[model samples]
Target: MINIQSGIPGFDQLTVSELTEGGIPEKSTTLIYGPPKTGKSIFCNQFTYNGLSNQEPCLYVSTDQGYKQVQRDMTDFQWLIQNYIQNQTIYFIDGISHLSGGKFENKNNIVSSSVSNPADLMVKVGIGTRNVYKTSNHFRSILDSLNTLFAFNPDQMVIKILKAYLRRITEAGGTGLIAYTEGITDPKTENELKSLFNNTIRLDGQHIHIKSDHPDFDEVQYFESTYTITDNGIVVNENNFKNIN
Candidate 1:
């Protein structure tokens, strides 16, 4: 009853009753790992939308997509992307400039940053997170993808940046989600990330798996679901996926 509802379609349903009763734990970091086109980004968007609906301060760091594209995609799903953008409750830290290589534009609740540089990313996240912390009592954030970060920096450097970012979120006692593309990063490298993040969700094609390694986790902490990623969002059709439990 006290857990943070994912607000993701069928995610809670796929998990058993305990998860729905408890929801996603606060101050927890979740990794949404999957192959290319596995719906990780849409899940992040839905999670942010859910936070906005709950009036929770939200931060969206676009590491892979441009601001305009993100807005357009969210609009297609009928989310009022601009309303939240204008309200200042949900902020977007633009990482597109790092990819597009243009002038940075910082506006109301919109932070433009050079995420290509590891040091700049750390500083930008620090500043943006601090600003959100100062104003909002509780907030949720999504770092769109670790793939871009890993692509730009060496494995060791990316790990350091990730560690710092996670620490900031934990210190703020906020919930966070960081997604990564599976397969591209070697198992040994990803294990380093898995060791740091408590909750792991893997999407291999249509199959879905979720495991929680939180301190309070019990044997029943694992679950699965079958879902389809569509233009709207992820659609969960059944409670049990593959009966892997």
Candidate 2:
């Protein structure tokens, strides 16, 4: 299995390359769940930026905010998505535009399409994913916040569609990250949603806990570390998180 570097030095060190190469395993989907303001979005930004820097095509499906805001945030961190946008290496599914009655417009060379409804999200993402694959079969993607869809649709429906969509991405040889709001669902519901991914990252303030499975390991492996989000992205004090179980 191939692994793509996560771009954050601390994440690479904390997870260790032996297990998953200190990065996200290629063609696998990872779930990122945490409370609000816990750096989940920043984590997604860093991952997306890493893919762009590596010339990997990326698809960002935004349900909680506009693609413009995401670009603005990446700019504030100096990640720079403009070049990628120009080159068409990055695509976005703006799930907010239709909700606002089409007030949003595609600016510059930004490649984006709006979803008409929650169910249409799958179609929008498929379009973005196919477009990215045109540049490279190996790509990266992120769906920002599943909670918004859950608000309008049934939890089971969201999970079922998300499972199918994530499976399609992986089958097409793409790695994906999904951001989900914690505490919005019961334990059973949360676990059920998390079950759809190959790996899970749970964030608590500056602390992060990761759960992953390796073919060589009989059981799942768990790791945790504290980190700070900086202008350069996530910063982990490599010394603080050596205990891996």
Candidate 3:
């Protein structure tokens, strides 16, 4: 099976290697959900940096912040993606730019577009993906914090849009990582959304759990793996914290 190596060392060791072929499964989408401040965004940043480092083009859709903020955040973590941005290997769809004084003047001529709503986001994503595909056949996309989309659109509408968009990612031979926040929806609604993805990475505070239909995964052994976010990225503790539920 095709796979892409996630840059985070601990994630690759504790989850990726055990669940898939030494990395995230290619042509499939993985949902990353967790409470706020649990390093979900950091995980995504690390993944994108890894992809860019490997010469895989990336499309990052930001529903919560502008592309500059994302750049600043990653830079703080010492994951400098500015070079990728300059070369157009990494593209962005900024959904919050309109909210914050419209689109900021992009002096770098980076491959990014601004969207005001979910409808616009869909259109921009389609355009963004097509553009990125021109750079490489194998690419990755990330939707940072799906919670913002849920806040503005009906649950069903968001799910419908996400499902279609995710399918497009897979069809184009690309992998996707969608970050989501837990406790925003009821359990039933949450489960429904989770069911759409090929894999689920749940971050609960300092503990993380991965669930997949792949038979090789030993659910009992991998449950509630402990981790801490450092400047480099996620660092998984060797001892699993079984009681952190």
Cα lDDT listed for each candidate: 0.78, 0.80, 0.78
Off by over 4 Å in 2: 106-116, 214-217
lDDT of 1 by residue, 1-245 (tens): 24677877777666655434534667788999988988888888888888888888887788888777788888888776687788788778888665676766688678777557767767778877877787674788899888888887788888888899999887986788998898757789888988888788888778788887677655537777778877678876674554344
Native-to-model Cα distance after best TM-score fit, residue 19 in candidate 2, in Å: 3.9
Rank by TM-score, highest first: 2, 1, 3
TM-score per prediction, in order, is 0.91, 0.92, 0.88
Best by lDDT: 2
Task: Quote model 1's TM-score.
Answer: 0.91
Q: List the RMSD of every prediction in angstroms.
A: 2.1, 2.1, 3.3
Q: What 10-residue stretch in candidate 1 is worst by lDDT?
A: 14-23
lDDT of 2 by residue, 3-50 (tens): 788887788778874445577778878999888998899899999999
Model 1, global lDDT? 0.78
Q: Give Cα distance to truth, residue 29, candidate 1, Å.
A: 0.3
